[model samples]
Target: MFLTYKDLSELFPNSRGIRDINLPFHTISSFAEQNQPKGLFIPLSEESGELGKAIENGAIGAIWEEGKEIPKYTPNHFPIFITNDIVKGFKEMTKQYMKKIKTSETKNMDMTKFLFLEEKLLNENFKTYDIAVVEENLSLYIEQLSEERRG
Candidate 1:
């Protein structure tokens, strides 16, 4: 599911909002290469250099560590969400979303159930490709449902 910047702020009240860029984002990644224009980036360390580079490459925002001073970049345009416990927060939120998927609907079956079936077909390994495919399908399915509801 997608999470707007405001939703993230609500989920993480302690997180500091930088530049107040309330954009919708999905997926979280630590790798700079994996960072997307609409995804949240969590740097490996509190290094301004890395974070700056990430923003240079189109990373929309970052999840910063709590109480840590932000970098002294010339223009701090990217939004930042500070967290007391980044690992725990990310894990708990991801788990919550997975649970939400279990209850959400799909085209012909429950999203979670269909994912389980797909995993079974793939010998239950549930490789990265399997997860990616499932996520893509579910995203499209959710969007279609939203459009239909609006119509």
Candidate 2:
């Protein structure tokens, strides 16, 4: 999936705003060698100055520990997402991405099935609801409802 730094900031607004590069990254990798051309590099325990290596290898950005010092030699303009807990942040991002995937896959599915899924989702007990999580599903339902009204 393609995501710019702006999109990331929108999804996780706490993140520092970096460039608006339209990098399409699919997965996050720890090792620079394994990083996909547009993927996000997460430097978990790199030696003091290794962030540049990851960026040089084609990572669009790096996610580093919140308090860890950023390498000075690394270009200041490169995007960096800092988190107190990298694993948690990564999992949250993955969950958001997966929802997008599921929604995209079901966009053309039958309305009845989508309705059932929406109902099931509503039945789940959460302390608070996030509308964005179910937005795509609801959009399909709304479209179908509108079409039924017109017909």
Candidate 3:
């Protein structure tokens, strides 16, 4: 869940163009106020001083643009991800996470189908084929999402 600022930039190519963009992670002030201990914080600069301040303020890590010289003040203990564009990386990561979650849901559906089939067989009922039709519909929905993601 720790995304560097550089990765976030790649995911949001127009970030520089926009004056404000809502970050996926909550703001540090909000996190502090809520006493939330776990979340990612992406700083906008590779400057060591700025990054160090963010880390000191409870940032778990950072994502910085590749080729930009990291400031010497950055602590070695803080994690960093260097990327060509942060926004794109963030978007790609989001897509992958969504796909994994969908796949897990599909697996759960498969288990349910097995259970239904078993029950039908035990009752000597031949209507279990209906489960296949339902599964086909589910598959179609998943396929549509996949196609949209690809586009």
List residue ranges in candidate 1 displaced over 4 A: 18-22, 44-49, 74-77, 106-151
> Candidate 2: minimum summed lDDT over ten consecutive residues — where?
109-118
State the displacement of the C-alpha of residue 66, model 2, in Å, after optimal TM-score superposition: 0.7
Better of 2 and 3 by lDDT: 2
Q: Report the Cα lDDT for candidate 1.
A: 0.53
Pairs with steric clashes in candidate 1: none
Question: Over the stretch 1-151, how does candidate 3's per-residue lDDT look in tens digits?
Answer: 2223444444544322222223333322111112222234333222223554555555554556677676687666544556675444433544543443345534323211111122212333432424454344434433444454567
**Cα error, candidate 1, residue 29 (Å):** 1.3
Error of 2 at 96 (Å): 0.8
Q: Given candidate 3, what's the lDDT at residue 86?
A: 45
Candidate 3 lDDT for residue 55: 55
Q: What overall lDDT goes with each candidate model? A: 0.53, 0.53, 0.39
